[model samples]
Target chain A: MNEERELAINPIVQTSVQHNTQVVSNIRNLTASLFGVAAGTLGLESYPGFIFYLIGTFIVSGLVFVFRAEGKPSEYFHRPLGDLWGGDVFSGLSSFVLTWTLFYGLVRA
Target chain B: MFSSPDRRLQIADSQIRRFTDSQIISMRHKNEANIIPSVYSTHEHTTTTPNSPLPLDITLELLASILLLSTGIVLTSQPLKPIQWSRWSGKMSREGRHGTGRWTREGEEVLSEGDPYAFLGLDGGGEGRRGFFDVRGKRREYAEWVKGEPGSK
Candidate 1:
């Protein structure tokens, strides 16, 4: 109680930005690759290929919030909750596309 | 056939038989040593790490070939990094910016390399109390961590 009072930091909404950022980026990259693999296997075309990844990323974000984060966005994320969950939506698109195209070519051929 | 030395002749014949048996046994050991080396040499090949691009399909399909080629570059290439470096306490003695430069610990802070007390966060100024950059004793900490590697913090 005294330590919290001395620093004047919010105990409820306290988390490290660096740690969250690393986690978010790591999740995005891995899911992007996985989404790409999925897209390729499903034989999804141009727009749908991209859409699949977007949806998958959202699902991953939800999983992170519910299971990994234990439904505590404010505690796990230093930035705005929306920013943490929604900000890096498109960050993994390139990797997803790379894998997606590769898979599609492989499966279709 | 000479009866007086018949025992000596029989002994000589036994000695010859023993010598032949020893020779045959020695030859067999030499052959085994040569054969064993060849058998082991075939299995002494180096093993490769099996992170092959195409693990799903065994057949050489067109899609698999194309995808393998396409992903080979992307998979091997290093991920993109927006910032090359975070620049924590970097020496900026380039051009005309001698002695004075900026150092970043928690955030950016203007610093003179020679100002030991102020640079190292031991200054008795009001900024010390406020912890403007919050880089208290970072210089010494960095110095200790670096082990004199010149700007490792």
Candidate 2:
């Protein structure tokens, strides 16, 4: 059998390749959204609310992306919506609390 | 003895992750003093397990919740109230305006008055609106309400 062919046929190699492909797909999604968020947040014409929105999106999306890349709920082959929601809820509550507590202090000071 | 060099190398690389994962699990379980090897290996790892962690049903539920949340936030953030106009035979309004041309309609039903809250799925106390977090509450409530149902916990 051909060397390259034999290697390519390995199930482990296939799994690795699948993993790599998933990573690349996730990276592309993140990069594209990151740019959009940055533009919205820092744009001269955009609302100041955009800045808070961007920060919130970043924290939530970052957590979700990491968990997804880590193969959370891997048995289903597709990442679960509950994972994303849990991530979003947790992040939202965190950002809401942090922004109010910390940002308010900074503004007041 | 006839395995090609590239084939052998490929096999080695393929075994690398699985071997590493197995070793890490073993090391973790054992909690041995010598943990230097797994430290370096687990650092660069992303997702390397012998099997996926979540079961099929729970996984699906989780996925459903995520989709719901993303869509919900986007839809709910927009101001979508419908325009309404009202008039009376003769009435003077503020700002030098007259003829009872008020926006409020006390008895008139607004067309296309779909509740945006409901649309975003925040309008109900039911499971459909609660997502995966509802599973536990719903189960416990039903178990108690079912009246002598077994496994009521």
Candidate 3:
């Protein structure tokens, strides 16, 4: 297959890939919770709160791209689009909602 | 564990600002409660009424804290290694066990684990190869060491 040939020519290190993925997910999860706190403090409700999360993720992605990936994502991630941008975007949702509700109650109360 | 000093400072600064901002908000809330004594008595009515918008200072502090926290998190995240096999191995070898030239002490420590070729240093291997062995010199040194031993007498 064409994919097999491409892989043969340009081999990937499994360990390095796992490490990079773990690092990205860790950052996403931590920052997602932080965004929840900010959104709750700002008194955002429903749709606006989710939108705030998207924007926050975008900023974190940009920061990782520039600072962590050193402006060349291809070197660090096999599939930069999925791994760096889209990956784990939703994984942080649970934690985000948890903190969002908790802080929303505290700040609004 | 291997965070930069700048990242630590930023996190500390943001936390302090966040604490102060929360304190200010709580104080303002207490003052409001004192002014409108009846409002506190009717908790359900107070809950029903929509809260006022956050003050400019609190909003600014929230934004500042988010920026500082995100920056610190990004900087503190583990540095990614090259994913390509050739590049990854090349980096490992080039950096070596201690990461002599490029990496800092902490970075070297973090990265020195699981080196594929590290075992080459064991037993008469790599640097201890027979080709480069000084047999005469080693024998002489071993003889001197044996002679100097306390039990030898």
Candidate 4:
């Protein structure tokens, strides 16, 4: 059982946690802002703007998982679904809303 | 009350400091150690002040543009470019590690192969194709950090 457990564990390849986090955060902040811009440009109202951000974030998360993690969540992320998909999911919302509101104001103005 | 030598020494030190007056009124002092940017800090210079300029002179539209541009870049950027994967993922025995290996990614095929060990971005073991380093060096760098290498950097 002990040997089996060891075998079940992953290999000794390198994974940069800090770099991964940085990449993720950058993605969140930058994209969230963009989402805000799009929503604003589209003149989306408060609730609609927020909803837009949520949907935008899901798209981004999906892309990050499929591309960055290569659909092997366990290999790249410790928490699998949580780490790859859900964690930091909401981070970009602020940026999205900010931009969305700004654009809405800009366009409406 | 009698003063001990240690007490006298402390008094003398303070007296000297006072006499210099120059020391207290010295030129503007800047804390070099405090200048490093903190990851968590919002970087606003003052929290007490209301309606102040942000740390980066950031405006609403500017902030928005930055975010959208970033998302676009991330989307357009090559897939799996940041990650490094070896052919062997299962339990790698000590001996098996040294054996020849190849680069692999999940979504793509037909390109990765024959990356030399000395430069494959392992624990400084990758030769980097004549001591060169790739953008994917983070994984190897991280591995080295995990091993607690003394100044492997």
Candidate 5:
């Protein structure tokens, strides 16, 4: 009761609580991208042969950073952290299309 | 304690106006408090709530696709299909822009990258659908639960 009374009278404690929640939200977002990279690496060796496989590794790492940007606050995800896994879905889908078109055009021709 | 009649009347009117103004301010404050509670409650629901977007089976399909793309394997025999990425890209681009300035060979590769859903965990190929990648049961379940609310219909 005393603590509540003090907090009600003190603006500083209320501000601190708000800031702490925002900080925790930020941490949750940062941790999510680490998961993104691990998920990205699941089928990496499925590419053609040697060179594409290395390319795959690089792609996954890059994805870790690229997708991390999406984990921040936005109207869509609407949290302190952006949606890293969601961004991975997007990047992966695009990567798939581009690879299929170029590979098909080159090999088939 | 006798003031002039006109003075007394003026004081009474002034006090009445002050009381009305405070009442209006209090009403506004109450409305604001109500809105704050509702917003907080909704936020609590989304982040803390544990609902899955796609059905468990479908989510497994989605995660398989993500896993494949993550592994850097593309199913070459298949034709390219554009999913909901264009919409996602629009939102992502607004934050830190991707693939700007000069496009390197590596950048080109990244741009023309394979399906991320394959890696994240979605199946993208079928007679009526497509497989993104492949996964077993436990890994599939873990991936689906971890990924965001899938926007696929």
Candidate 6:
């Protein structure tokens, strides 16, 4: 397969990949929860709340792209779009929701 | 070396942010308890209304904090090594073991387990390998050195 040849030609370092992924995911999860606090503090509801999460994540991704990836995602990630942008978005959602609801109640109560 | 200061700054920033957040929340709670009685005043309602948008200052502060936090996290993360074998090996040989400064929390250098070929040169394998040694050539060189000495003449 073409994929096999491509991999053989330019082999990827598994440890480096895992380390980079772990760092990005850790940042995403921490920032997602922080975004939840901000949204809840601002009293955002329903659609606006979710939209805020999206925007926050986009900003985080942009920061990672610019500073972390050094404007070249392809060098760091195997699939730049999937790994850097979309990867672990869902994984952070649970923590986001947890902090979102907790702060929403605390702020509004 | 450079990351230590940056990480300290990040920690300070987060601590300050947490303090500010708690202060703001506590102040809001205090205001709510004292300002609003059973009468349900319009002024209290205007400020405490769930539908009302947050002040511009608070919104700006939140966005700024997010930006700062993201930058800190990105900068503090470990630098990624090249994935290609050739590049990786070049980097390893260039930086050597201590040049990378990848130390553990206990201040020990992280051993690179990825390079299996590292052992090839560790024991002088290339220069001293069996069957490659020229014993006769060494003996000839030693005799020539002795004959050229002043004591031999």
The regions of model 3 sitting more than 4 angstroms off are B1-51, B99-111, B114-153
- TM-score of candidate 2 versus the correct structure, residues matched by position: 0.18
DockQ of prediction 4: 0.06
Docking class of 1: incorrect
- Best candidate according to DockQ: 3
- Clashes, model 5: 51
Flag clash pairs in model 3.
none
Rank order by TM-score, top first?
6, 3, 4, 1, 2, 5
TM-score (chain B) for candidate 5 is 0.18
Candidate 3, residues A36-64, lDDT tens digits: the string is 87887677899999999999999999999
iRMSD per model?
A: 14.6, 22.9, 5.1, 10.5, 22.9, 5.6
lDDT per residue as tens, model 2, A27-47: 334333322322221221335
Give DockQ for candidates 1 onward, in order.
0.03, 0.02, 0.50, 0.06, 0.02, 0.36
Candidate 6 runs further than 4 Å off: B1-52, B99-114, B122-153
Shares of reference contacts reproduced by the candidates, in order, are 0.00, 0.00, 0.80, 0.09, 0.03, 0.50
Q: lDDT per residue, candidate 6, A1-109, as tens digits?
A: 9999999998888877887788879988877887787666666789999889988888888888887788988888888899889878989988988888886776665
TM-score of each: 0.38, 0.18, 0.65, 0.42, 0.16, 0.67
For candidate 4, the TM-score is 0.42
Select the stronger candidate by DockQ from 2 and 3.
3
Show model 2 residue runs off by greater than 4 Å. A1-60, A71-79, A85-91, A98-101, A107-109, B1-153
Chain A of model 5, TM-score against the native?
A: 0.29
The CAPRI-style docking tier of model 2 reads: incorrect
Residue-level lDDT for B137 in candidate 3: 88
Error (Å) of candidate 2 at residue B53 is 49
Clash pairs (backbone) in predicted model 1:
A105-B63, A106-B63, A106-B64
Q: How well is each residue in B1-153 modelled by candidate 3, as lDDT tens digits?
A: 223446535644555555444454343333232312211222332356555444444455456657666766787677998998888888876776663245665665334545664555545545653455679888999998988886776
